[model samples]
Target: MDHYSFDQLPHAVSELHQKLDSIQDLLLESRQPVPQTIELMTISQAAEFLNLSVQTLYGKVCHREIPVSKKGKRLYFYKSELEEWIKSGKKKTMSELREQLPSLVVGRKGRRH
Candidate 1:
C-alpha cells in the first residue's frame, strides 16, 4: 500500500471514513428484508390489513376478487399479492398521465423536434 505523507493524511482520512460509512450501510441493509418481502397473513390479519370486515373479506375470497391460498379449511394471503390485487384496482391519477405517454418526453438523437 502507498503511504500518505502528513499533508495528504487528513484528506485520505476523510476518504477512508466515507468508505467505511458506506460499507457499514451495506452491511445493515443486507441484514434487513425488503419492504415487499413480508410474511403470509391469516384471514383475520388479512381482513384487518385491508380494513375490511371478516364477512367482506370472505365475500371477496368467494368472488375471487383477491389472491389467496387455501389449504383444507384454512386460508392464507401474502401481503405482496394482496398489495398487487389492490394495485390492479387503482386508476391512474391525473398527475400520473405523463407516465402513459406514447412518445419519449425526453427524446434522444433525431427523435426530439
Candidate 2:
C-alpha cells in the first residue's frame, strides 16, 4: 500500500476553494447591466419616425424588406436599422433621378463650325 503526503492536502484544498470563489465572482458580475447606446423602437414609433403610414410599415415587414422583430403580438425595430433603411431608400431614389436627368434636359449647345 502507498502512503499519501499530508502536507500536500491543505494546499490542494485551498486552491480548489480559490477557483470556486473566482467562478462565483464571474457569475455574479455577468448579471450586471450592460450600457446600450442604441434604443429599440416599437413599430408605431418607427413608422412615425420614417413618416410612413403604419399599414405601409406593416406591409414592408410582411414582405421582409424591413428589419423587425415580433414579440408576442407586438413588433419591434432597432432605430439604427430603420435609419439605414431610410438612407438606402433615399440613395435608390437619388440614383433613379440621376438616370432620368438626361431626358429632362432638352436644351443642348451645338458645336459652331
Query: What TM-score does candidate 2 get on C-alpha atoms?
Result: 0.47
Whole-model Cα lDDT of every candidate shown, in order: 0.90, 0.85
| Best candidate according to lDDT | 1
The residue ranges of model 1 lying beyond 4 angstroms of the native Cα positions read: 1-38, 98-113
Global lDDT of model 1:
0.90
Cα lDDT of model 1 by residue, 50-105, tens digit: 99999999999999988999999999999989989998999888667777553455
Cα RMSD to the true fold for all candidates: 9.5, 13.3
Model 2 over residues 89-113: C-alpha lDDT tens digits?
A: 7645788888887866743434335
Cα misplacement distance, residue 45 of candidate 1 (Å):
0.3
Error of 1 at 35 (Å): 10
